[model samples]
Target: MTRPLLDVRDLRVTFHIRREGDLPWTQPRELHAVGGVDFSLAPGETLGVVGESGCGKSTLARALIGLVPAEGQAEWIDGKDLIGLSPRQMMKYRNDIQMVFQDPLASLNPRMTVGQIIAEPLTTHHPGLKRAEVKERVKAMMEKVGLLPNQINRYPHEFSGGQCQRIGIARALIVEPKLIICDEPVSALDVSIQAQVINLLIRLQRELGLALIFIAHDLSVVKHISDRVMVLYLGRVMEIASSDDLYAAPQHPYTQALLSAVPVPDPAHDMAASVVPLAGDLPSPLAPPSGCVFRTRCPRATERCAAEVPVLSGAGHQTACHFPGPLTEAEIAFARRTEAA
Candidate 1:
């Protein structure tokens, strides 16, 4: 087996938030944003992380690249433990790991020219690079990500939403990072634009031999780009498997419900689907239920589910649930038909 380029184990992120109607002396409440997430990525592999909003998908990504404080090991194959590094200490690994945010224009500095924005990482990480060298590399990267070399002098305001995203891609790739964390990179674009960006990332990953942690709520998009799929709920892993196995035979109730909700391409097929989509609001992370976080909303949930937290098990496929099995065909059909209220 090729050693994983990135191996994350029992990663957790927590935040202390002030109460809504705050009293100055009140102690902050603990918000368990990422309860415990574990996964690994080999060189050139893509791991798609899917979950509903506030399920800790974004928080997990942020924790991996050192954007937020994380507990547990994020061991890069080179032996660096990202969780222990300080801001200044982490600087050395910036080129090895990069991130592309969701909003294109919002991520860029409108005051800076495209060249300046893209070259910022290079300048910061490679301070010895001459101005001329930075410009040359930035222009080359622009060409790679479908941007124009001559447009380097243009500010972000001059570009469209899709173009601004291309600029973000160019910026992330400029340093030739080993891994790229794409946090809903396509969510802000048009469907057509989303396709273009997805394809661009696919090709770029192949060309650069880069690993990717693609985090998004869109199951179809995740299926398209990922070799493996991980399902998360309430800051914890629900199930994980190869994309084929995941879509065809999802074990966890949450994964099945999520896949059932993905729009079928054929109207006839959608009409034929009987699986009920999940219902009920995602429970607050601040005061999660005693055992499995998903029990409150799970149809098969029982007293055992409320008494014990299930552990993930398996070699090629893993699921964390008291039942530890896939939904029956009948249940899948019900899940397909039941839409969220």
Candidate 2:
């Protein structure tokens, strides 16, 4: 087996929430944002994480990069645990791990010029370089991401949504990091523009040999770029498998329901007509439903599913489902017969 370049084990993150009319001395309840998630990524591979909003997809990305406080083991490059590192210790790890946040406008500093923003990492990590070298490096990064070198002097608000995201990418890539945590990088852009940014990311990944943890709510977007895809619900992992296998024959009920909702391109077979609608709002992370978090929304859920949380098992494909089965030939035939009738 190819050894994973980055490995996350039982990663968990929680936030404290105060109860109503509670005294300041009272201990706040812990809201589990990420609960015992595990996955690994090899070099030059993209691991896509997909789920609905509030599913902790974004939180998992932030946790890996140490942007948010978290607990659990994160081993990268040299078997070092990132979660246990101090701020000073984490500073050394910064150049190896970078993040491109969801909103470029919000992520980028308004006062700083694009060149300044992109060069900030170098200044912090490689301050020995001369000012001239920094300017050259910043301009080169802009050009690499299909931006005009002349615009290196421009501010964040001066660029278009797509351009801003490109600048964000340039900044993330300027450090030449080993892995990038992209949290919905293009979800805020126009559909046409999303393709451009995704293409840019793919091209850069190929050229630079970078590993990526791409987090998004849209499975179609993830399907376009991911090598492996993992489905998340609430704060827990539901399934993890190769992109092709997961899409072709999803092992989990949640994964099937999500794929069923994807709009089919062929107008003759409208997916909306055949797709199953997911019911109920996603339960609050503060008080997630007992056992399987998805039991309330799953169609194949049973009493056992509600009584115990299924562990992720299997050799190649992993799923947290008590009753795991593919759509058998018999089931497919029956469905086709019903459609014919």
The candidate scoring highest on lDDT is: 1
> How much lDDT does each candidate structure score?
0.89, 0.88
Q: Which candidate is the best by TM-score?
A: 1
Lowest summed lDDT window (length 10), candidate 1: 332-341
> How do the residues 1-341 of candidate 1 rate in per-residue lDDT, one tens digit apiece?
98899988999998999968999899999999999888888889999999999999999999988888889898898878889798898998888899999999999998999999999999989999999999999999999999889999999999999999999999999999999999999999999999999999999999999999999989999999999999999999999899999999988888877776777777678534544556567889999998888988777788999999888888889989889666777765444445332
What lDDT, from 0 to 1, does candidate 1 have? 0.89
Give the Cα-based TM-score of candidate 2 against the true structure. Answer: 0.94
lDDT of 2: 0.88
RMSD of 1: 2.1
lDDT of 1 at 90: 90
TM-score of predicted model 1?
A: 0.95
Q: Each prediction's TM-score against the native? A: 0.95, 0.94
